[model samples]
Target: MRVVTFCDIDESVIDSKHTIENFQSGCSGEAQIAILDINSIFDFEENKHEACADKFTTIAIVEDDSDYDAFKNFGIDAWIKADDFSDINELINLIEKRLFS
Candidate 1:
């Protein structure tokens, strides 16, 4: 699986389609990015999550409600509230179990 991040993102998050496509592993792009092609003709949020379900996963961990609202608009698969966990280890354990189990 892959995780792609966009700094200073806009509400039109789907605009980063090319960046995601070129992120596939073993892709021969200029920067040797990963190209996990799900055979998508166009990059739309509707099938994007499903198309890359096996190849990519998006997640966010926010410390504030405002942050959560902002990140949620960015279309991530999962959101972990930092406040829900007491410490980094506990948070990490939950993440590991969620991802591996």
Candidate 2:
């Protein structure tokens, strides 16, 4: 699956175990999943918003509990803490389950 992320994820955490693909912002393509790290960016462009809307699944990463409510208007499918997961594989597994199950 083609996975895109807006944050500067530590790819090394998952690169050895799984192949992670990332697409740049404003790219025209269908993505299986899109991860938005709100901790890094509070807001994005209209095009990026539209792109995430087209994604099958969209996960938002936030730093605080109040951040979830702040991003509620963005049509986010799910959310996770910015530093909750130690490995990208865990995040990937969570997304897989949420998307498939």
List CA RMSD, all candidates.
11.1, 3.5
What is candidate 2's lDDT per residue for 1-101, written digit by digit as tens? 45566676766665454434455534434556666776534443343544443546776877888888877887777677767745556767777776656
Q: List the residue pairs that clash in candidate 1.
A: 23-34, 24-34, 24-35, 24-36, 25-34, 25-35
Model 2 off-target regions past 4 Å?
A: 15-28, 39-45, 48-55, 97-101
Off by over 4 Å in 1: 1-54, 85-101
Task: Tell me how far the alpha carbon of residue 30 in candidate 1 is from the true structure, in angstroms, after superposition.
Answer: 16
Candidate 1 local lDDT, 37-83, one digit each (tens): 11221232443443343444444545566765555554555554545
Weakest 10 consecutive residues of candidate 1 by summed lDDT: 32-41
Per-candidate Cα lDDT values, in order, are 0.37, 0.62
TM-score of 1: 0.32
* Residue 74 displacement in candidate 2 (angstroms): 1.3
Q: In candidate 1, how many Å is residue 3 off?
A: 7.6
Local distance difference test, candidate 1:
0.37
